[model samples]
Target: MYVQSENPVEITEAILKMDIRPKDLIVLLVAESDNLNLQALIDRLNEAGVSFIGGIFPGVIHNSTLHKVGVVVKKLQSVSAPVIIQGLNTSDYRWPDFTPTLSGLEKKVTAWIMIDGLMPNIASFLSGLYDRLGDRVNFIGGGAGSLTLEQKPCLLTPNGLLQDAAVIALLDYDTHLGVKHGWKRLAGPIVATRTSHNIIYELNWEEAFTVYKNYVEKDCDCKMSPANFFEISKCYPFGISKSNAEEVVRDPISVNSDGGLVCVGEVPENTVLNIMKGIPENLIAAAAEAVEETLNQSAHNDYVRHTMVVDCVSRALFLEDRHEEELEQISRRIKAVRPEVSPQGMLSLGEISSYGEGYLEFFNKTIVIGSLY
Candidate 1:
């Protein structure tokens, strides 16, 4: 069952009212960036014996409405174990080192991952997780951070809150995942000539911003400036190509004085990239298509209990007034598949999923729909 309320005390009371004891629960909280009482809320849930995993988001979805200040809870019907790992820095993190810790769990496990959105090692982290778990473990989750862009202890695990770290909940259940980013390549597969970490210094042997500005100005017919970069860049993102898979997007956060571009995730040197753009209608349609695909892949005999939608906040910002329409599109499709289940989601900083066919990747300007049974 799903429950939400703006008042912390009221939300806790509602969870306690549920007569059926849940083996686990997932919590999504949308609070002010400067709110310092987060620890108290976690302590309250811990004292109540609710095993949960989630984090702070700019906005959360409950039923069909998007809320900016509230707590959304999903009571898990099956047992789950949350593994919290810390000490994740740009230089010193490996998935193989953590693989041994996940051993001895059930054969059919679904892993739900939540990571710091600002962490520069996200690409390496996803690659390492896929290398260790292979295709045996199904997973879907997103980056957790506030609108302020400052890193903090946003991820909540059973132990406590975490920052610059990741939390994984290994569940013994079945799940179906569908991923889509409604972005089309606007320009060539240009090579990233010089890059370090998440900063791109040059593209195609030219200044990164120079090339970016030329293409964007030509495509959108608008002049580019540092002041208006974000406002205009939201409609245009960088797409990194992969073999036989949909392109992964990276949102450029800002431009450096050296004319380099700083992105949310790493843009490795020699990586081929394409300038991408999306229309609001196309993005909404892609979300609906994702829901349809997920339903089609699901086992017909098994009943779906809950659906989790993790979409990039960049898309939400792009949609603006039509943001709720995107959610409505998802709801309409999900209801057509299974009217009994309601979809709950959040505007994530980034999205994570692999559909159980390939290596997991951290994506931006994308939508990930997951069905948990």
Candidate 2:
């Protein structure tokens, strides 16, 4: 259910009294930054007699705006479905070692992880964790935002909510196999002729600066500056690749002081990439397209189970004041079609999707577009 209320405890209480089976595995996504009385929320959960795993998000979702918080609850159908699992936000999740966290949970499939934006080496960490989910599971969702206050102290997790750590959660359900996500390069299909880790050395052999500058010039004529670059391409919104062959941020084209372009994650030397754009209209269409594709993989969907959108905050920033409009549009389009994509979602800092055909990317599927075709 899409809940935009500030009182999560009251919301939970309402849900529990609704004849929600006792065995239901409650997943409470408090997508707000309010200093949730952690102890109080936990007390309520314990009282509910339901197994739950969720955290506090930075942004709250009241009317609109992607940078908001809210709660989303999904009840298990038959058995205590273990389709989703959320692990502790502790130091055990280091680099490649996160592979084993899914050792026994691989069978559960989809993983919805939420971390703090300030978490060190998060994108790389997610890439490593994805490598371990085998090929059938998809890893989506990055850092969930919080109020500036929490940002100073990073919201704590079930174990503890603070910065400097990450949380890994898994979803296991037979009905869950219904979702899918894919990506195809948009703008350039521009092959990275030269590059580094997260830095584009050159594009088509032209100084990365010249190539991107020319491209931006063609679209918008403005005095270029460090801050101007972000305004130009709307924070380098990127395209997706399908073959799953590319690494790093495939479509991002950020501008450097010297006039070169800086991609988000990384781009190996000579890897083909695409400069992409998801204009508000395009984003709406993509939202629709994402649903269309998900239907391709799974059919006879009983109800549009709540969706957990792991959208890139850069996209959110790109939307600026219209970010709320964008989320509303997405929610409207999805609900218009599926009516179950959950009007509620989180504005993630960054997102990681599978390249090849190993894991079934989740966050990339429901709320994402063109990336998972």
Candidate 3:
């Protein structure tokens, strides 16, 4: 069931009071940027004494809530359980369980892997995960969120706390998932030309700023150039490729002043890009289509029950208050169309999921859904 409240601990208490058992700890840890509030939520997780771990994302999803980061716990009572494996004292316990999950499965199963974005080995970790999972599973979700000037982020751990760690949930079962990648296409008519690899070494084959200046235009554009990414961040987003389906598997992350694009995950080199135009209607259509596919793909007949969304924080900068207005209808549509739909979502930097749980060919794309029932 989808639920939300100001008190996560109370939420846990409610779950524990319900049919939730200690072993069924499939909790998701996405943090709110506010340090103090994040700590309070972490404190609740520690008290729960559940074998749970997750990386922080830009936002958290629950029944009807949108915006801001939060934590969620979904307990599978009568549902089929995905394997939960943790590496206690390994070199990097983060990807240990994922290898088996991806390698063995030939169909589809989704996994939620929380990671350390600042880690030097982060790209490597993702690579290992993608390699092992193969086409049988999909990868989504994200690295933890942080306001820290240092590379380290406060990871929410099992001991009533947060730490710098990684966790994975290998869900190989009968389930359905849905994902919506909404970008505000805020940048004006500038094009991402002369890009080798996914990194924009040069825009228009000229210095990056020159390319940017050409886009912004005018004298005010010069001074604003310093924080160009900051100003137009809401509208212009960096598109990251999830599936290899050319335009089909792509989304954008925002850029920063250091010439480094602060995308959700690493935007690999040589990735073709576009300085997109964000139209409100287009964004809504994309979201609706993604959600519809999930419903259509699963049919909600014998087993479809819950859906979780992973959205980007940059999207909010563009949509402002209207983002939720557009998203609420998403909830309504799912409920109206799918009788078994129990949808809860987070408007965060990224999401994780897998499809058909048993479909082996879905490996390595960004997983948007997983099922335990």
Candidate 4:
């Protein structure tokens, strides 16, 4: 359920009215624009004595529209309390032992992950998570942080609002995931010759910004500047090659002082990249396709189920007024399968999923829809 009010007391009251038992797990997705006094909310929820985990995102989704000043309160079923992993910004931080947590859960359960979007070691952290969990669980969730690209206290746990940290809840549910990004290659096969974590210093042995600007300028016949880089770069992202599936997109949010391109997620050294371009029609179609894929993967015959949509905030920005069309397509497709269920999720800084019996990944400019049954 979505609480339109941002007030901590009021939101907590609503949660209480829901009659959420002590064993129920709650996912509180907050909009960054709400400027919530997270501590107050946390205190209230704790006072009510309920287990929960959440994060502040660019926006929250309820039905087909996006809310910039509301909260999405979703109740989940987990085998254990949510685990908190700190020091995501530090490369050497030890990954905590989750054996005690996983040992209690079934061999194939769903894991809901929420992480700090601006942290540099997101890919590394996800890799470590997959290594520990193996293929025993399917992963679904997104990166949480403000669109301002600032790193701050975002993730929510029973302990407190945390920064440079992640929350992993081993849900006692099964989810079918569909991941897609309708970006076609405009230019490509450029190797990231010199790169650090999420910054690319060179592409094909040339200045990263220079190579990027050249291609974008030639395609649109316009001048590129740091001031307008983000505005223009939204239409053109870098896609990392993957064997049979769609190339994973990397959103270049800005150009640093050293002429390096800073992306939302990591771009490793020597990675081959393609400059991708998106059209509104294609993006909207891809969203519908995601719902169709999710429905196809689902094997349950139950009439009641839940749907979660993790779409990129940048995609919404690029779609502008037409973003609703993408949401509508998803809704229409989902209703065709489960008419009673509505699409609910967040406009995330980045999307995460273990795509199609494949490995876990952090993606940008993409849409991931997970249907829980």
How would you encode candidate 1's per-residue C-alpha lDDT over 180-207 as one tens digit per residue?
Answer: 9889989988899999888899999999
- Candidate ranking under lDDT, highest first, comes to 4, 1, 2, 3
Task: Give each model's whole-structure lDDT.
Answer: 0.78, 0.49, 0.48, 0.89
lDDT of 4 by residue, 129-158 (tens): 999987888899999999888889899888
lDDT of 3 by residue, 18-120 (tens): 5656445555545455243545655675676555555555556554466353456555332123332233223546434445434555555556555554443
lDDT by residue (tens digit), candidate 2, 245-319: 332343343555655556444456776666544455554455555545544455444444545455555555555
Residue pair clashes in candidate 1: none
Candidate 4: 10-residue stretch with minimal lDDT: 297-306
- Pick by lDDT: 1 or 3, better one: 1
The candidate with the higher lDDT, 1 or 2, is 1
Best by TM-score: 4
lDDT (0-100) at residue 109 of candidate 1?
Answer: 60
**Candidate 4 TM-score, true structure as reference:** 0.97
What does candidate 4 score in Cα RMSD to the true structure? 1.3
